[model samples]
Target: MPDITTSAVAPTRLRIPRQRGQAPGTSPSGPILREHIDAMIDLHPGGLTWRRTFPGTLDHIPHARHFTRYLLADSDHRHDAELIAGELSANAVRHTASGRPHGTFIVEINRTTTTITIAVYDCGWGGVPRFGRLFGIDAEYGRGLTIVAALADQVGYEGAEEVGHRVWARMVQPSG
Candidate 1:
């Protein structure tokens, strides 16, 4: 993971274009919705780490998903990582400040020999994520966290909504 120990010199920020007349964060939040998309990618130290700031627009969710897939192309957990990335991006765009006009979200994909970690950092103005599952067909959408937890060997979140919050998932795979 990239270092962000201080706010003065934190993660790199980049601008993403948005369409006019769109109500910014009011777009319906879901998967596979592609609006105009733009983002920035930052390569970190280990060379195995990649961080990007993407516009919180709904269309960018697919961009995030594809970004994770591209990063993990040679890994065994590529598919799982892609799904988790999409879900996390959706949450960031729908529930956090990332969804607002000009708002952005951070996506970091770090891989080691035996484990891969995907972390999504959202603008800290919305509700933080938690593990919640509604057991019903018509219970809206509440299985994202649960799905993430079930797929990743380790899943967790930290930080505050004031500055930002990060939701992460870690997968461990054996080298056959």
Candidate 2:
């Protein structure tokens, strides 16, 4: 593996084309999204792994699993691939506090020579993650951050300035 101390670099933005006229489920949005993520993975000098998480709701898991399988089939490191389904499921639970039961979440993976980053963007009720003291020890909720922290070297939120919200994790890759 490359030196893990190398400074982190921003991912190169790829132009994702909008599918016009195509119905929501008819067009190739999922495949296009997967392709964009694969391009990012290709930029990594090291091997790459990817996974996706969906809403906890039964309706969304199929879509999530479909996209995740597409990405994982092309991955080189399945073992290190972050298990994001649980995190997104938790976010869905939080967002559904309103009466609406429908939402979507996406997870993308990318890496550089030494660092790997996983990002989960959701159309959830947006807010920064509440850390310690926000939830009690016996509480079943609020454990998403703990899972993220344990699995990731660093984690943070972004997109407060935008419509949707994204949570990301960056970690040093283990040598192959």
Model 2 RMSD, rounded to 1 decimal: 10.7
**After superposition, which runs of candidate 2 have C-alpha atoms over 4 Å from their true positions?**
1-80, 96-102, 132-134
- Minimum summed lDDT over a 10-residue window in model 2 is located at 73-82
Model 1 over residues 2-92: C-alpha lDDT tens digits?
9745334223222233457767765443332111111111133343678999998999999999899877664568899999999998999
TM-score of 2: 0.53
Encode model 2's per-residue lDDT on 1-176: one tens digit a residue.
87667464444333334577656545343332434654576675665756555544646644654454444443343323435544644464455321145555666666554566666676645565543336687997677777766767777777652456677767675433
Write out the backbone clash pairs for model 1: 35-59
| Residue 144 accuracy (lDDT) in model 1 | 88
lDDT of each: 0.78, 0.55
